[model samples]
Target: SDLPLLCQHFINNYNQENGTTVKGISNETLQLLTTYHWPGNVRELNIAIERACIDARKGIITVDNLLRFTQNVSRQNISSENYRGFDIKEARKEAEKAVIIRALKASNNNRRKAAELMEISRSALYNKIIELEID
Candidate 1:
């Protein structure tokens, strides 16, 4: 409801500020954005939209534009078999894996620091790494 309007406002503001002529986002792309959980909230949404606008280059922001918004998460084509029939458990696993990988990378591969960043015990983090089969 209001999400689309919010996104539109963001896009309009960005276009005005940057002197770009991005018309609007496609319906499909808008649906995707509105439906996303947006774990990082409004700030993350703002950054994602801004980045997408830059990548769009005066064109209507497409799904491709949003797909590149986050490196940690996989927001690729939903029509792909990989995303088809997705369940909560699988989605949770994917999210956990992404977070763990991000934490590890941020901590320079130091498991203890990564665990601290995640607010989990070192052994718990180690167990998750093994369970998720993260190299």
Candidate 2:
């Protein structure tokens, strides 16, 4: 697939322009990118890789970085075709985790505040955090 090559090319460009030594994309991140339908094609992929590079740390583009990229740029572009082979349970889990993480961040990691933001009880939020295995 051209995805890896294109991702590497974008990562190389980011490293050169920023003087950052982002080594490469993680296998998990690559898998996610490959599975994505990329409705916008190469141009969308390029932007996603660039966004991932900007958010990347610890020398590699991670699933977290790509998740953020997708969340920000492709939320409006999602389609049913993207869910063709995806398990509904797993998709729901991922969506829940993303929302919980976003709430945590918005609340500065304060469980009570995050729970309030989500209109859920603190204990419920705690249970979700444990179930989701969120750090």
Candidate 3:
């Protein structure tokens, strides 16, 4: 967010004062970064800024730093982005069934009370169990 950019600027200023001459960020990089949706958030920005600072020499921070960050984290989190080509519908149904079963167990098989706790209608809960064929 705004905090990471401010921190990066501050780091740049520190480098400037110490005569190290950190490269200024580019407009194109800023444009894409601002437009893109960053779900993982400011931590990703911090890594990017660090990489940029490390690679800077002639006063221009290229997009290469950002590319390096993506390449590094992509390998670590490929599973989160893809379900390994499994059927999404089946996975979702399985998850819904698991939730209902857990709710029933947590409420000691009291269907009405489980419905209230789950914020779902009792009729809907009954329909789901019947559809899933859970005893």
Candidate 4:
């Protein structure tokens, strides 16, 4: 279907910008994607492709990588296990990590903008990034 070609368009664009060599989406992943209703249309497809590109491993976008697109992507970022512990400090760390990651993704990995999105100083964001080991 044209969906695969559309997916490839976004994937190729992402690879060019990121200097990544992601070959393409796997057949299974393409099948999965084609089955979705894509209620948000092309914009949603674009986001899904971007997210899959970021999460793709070993130069291929797999079914596992596309799974997040089918669900509430933001809600899946911080797994429930992160908050299962009783320690507030640990919970706080998990929350901060999740927020920082989200901000980074939202800002397209622009640290300065991510800091602004998080309402913190750039230095503070760097410090938190270091403390939390966010790569």
Instruction: Give TM per candidate.
Output: 0.54, 0.64, 0.39, 0.51
- Which one is best on lDDT? 2
Give the alpha carbon lDDT tens digit for every residue of 1-135 in model 4.
Answer: 799899999999998999988889887667556646677898888888888788789978875465433343322322222356655456556756777787799899999998886667999999989998999
Lowest summed lDDT across 10 adjacent residues in model 4 is found at 73-82
lDDT of each: 0.71, 0.74, 0.58, 0.72
Candidate 3's TM-score: 0.39
Kindly give the stretch of ten consecutive residues in candidate 1 with the minimal lDDT sum: 72-81
The C-alpha stretches of model 3 lying farther than 4 A from their native spots are 1-10, 13-19, 72-135
Misplaced by over 4 Å in model 1 are 72-135
Looking at model 1, the pairs that clash are: none
Per-residue lDDT over 1-135 for candidate 3, one digit per residue giving the tens place of the 0 to 100 score = 575466457557647656777656665456435644556676665565666666665766544433333433322222121123455455445545656676788799999987785667999889988987989
Clashing pairs in 2: none
> Considering TM-score, where higher is better, how would the candidates rank from best to worst?
2, 1, 4, 3
Kindly list the per-residue Cα lDDT of model 2 for residues 18-64, writing each as its tens digit: 89999999986777677667778988888888888887889899766
lDDT of 1 by residue, 1-135 (tens): 777877788899998999998888878677666656778888887887888898784588876566545432233323111233456456546656766787899899999998886667999889989998999
TM-score of 4: 0.51
Residue 123 displacement in candidate 2 (angstroms): 22
Better of 2 and 3 by TM-score: 2
